[model samples]
Target: MGSYGKLVRDQIPEIITAEGREPITYIASRDEYHRRLREKLTEEVAEFLSADDAAALGELADVLEVVHALAMSLGIDSVALEELRQAKERERGGFTRRIVWTGNR
Candidate 1:
């Protein structure tokens, strides 16, 4: 009985029906889908940042879901995405060392 103009999982309407509710929904066109995916990513990141200790992992998982969807929208599969990530890490290293940049000379 509420209005929410945002992207959601494909199974959400089915879940709502199972819960005995009438859920209004529609499929997004390709361009709209891409735009909404970006918005969803920002929303998910905010949730992840504000999540408490007990719920942090769950929020992080949601963020990951948005990320994967965004990547796929750009025609990148998981394997290819992983390869790009690894390539970047190899070139610039990762956060393992916790290196902090100080003021330059």
Candidate 2:
């Protein structure tokens, strides 16, 4: 059997079972769950960046789901997160301008 000790979607085990395979899984501790969720965020972001146009949206959705989990784990729900995001956007702005700075001046 292959080893993949990473966080996965809630329905993954069910999907595995539907495919005629039994998935071996266990519950992670609170700290371990937070750590794994962070790792999953990184993994999903990389996957989203590398995906082709046809699969990019799905990969991006996975990344968002991971981000949501991370926020919840940190005691910040979506509304709070969005509030923080807007505050940052108002103060520092966002990437809308597509500005590419080259070096310190």
Candidate 3:
């Protein structure tokens, strides 16, 4: 049996397969996965900054996936962090408005 981390990584292929499509899900003996992630982040950041709504949404999803991987690496539960965010939003305010930065320099 593979380790928990390996199992989690392996699930990427299984998920793609379940979606009625084929995808290269294995990162074995390759750095392509990390490279693709970096490329996706770059694309998303560009789209987000350009105010492309659809692309921004896609990029946000990619960013969330990266965050999930980071959380998994740190043995942290992402769901708990999301819940904390929700709680904080309730206590304070959600990201509903844009804050304008006045020249303070």
Candidate 4:
């Protein structure tokens, strides 16, 4: 039996093969992935989108997988990328506070 992560990783290539063309999978899956990512981002934006927390978490995992694939294609290590994220967080305040818009509506 494959590990859960392995099974999920295998699905990408399987999806490609089942579609019988690279573009089909890329187009379909990428759009689906983009939609889900957008939903998650929207939730974060509004601060009231926790109804699909589990689903959103899964979508986030999928997004990370896609991003990891892209980074690998471009010869980037995920760990190094994360370190860069940490560095950025150090330079800028992290997302722990809410922004208040007090200007013109």
Each candidate: what lDDT? 0.89, 0.89, 0.61, 0.56
Q: After the best TM-score superposition of candidate 1, give how far the Cα of residue 30 lies from its true spot, in angstroms.
A: 0.8
| Candidate 2 vs. true structure, TM-score | 0.88
Candidate 3 residue runs with Cα over 4 Å from true position = 1-47, 99-105
Q: Which candidate wins on TM-score? A: 1
lDDT of 2 by residue, 34-73 (tens): 9899888888888999999999999999988888899999
Give stretches of model 1 more than 4 Å off: 1-4
* lDDT over C-alpha atoms for residue 84 of model 3: 77
Candidate 2 global lDDT: 0.89
- Please rank every candidate by TM-score, starting with the best: 1, 2, 4, 3
Q: How much does each candidate deviate from the true structure in C-alpha RMSD?
A: 2.5, 2.3, 7.7, 10.0
The digit string of per-residue lDDT tens for model 3 on 1-105 reads 222123233477778899999874444333544444455556556666776666778667766776665454456689976887899999987878976668886
- Candidate 3 structure, TM-score to reference: 0.46
Sort by lDDT, top down from the best: 2, 1, 3, 4
- Give the C-alpha lDDT of model 1: 0.89
Residue 35 alpha-carbon offset, candidate 4, angstroms: 17
User: How many clashes does the backbone of model 3 have?
Assistant: 0
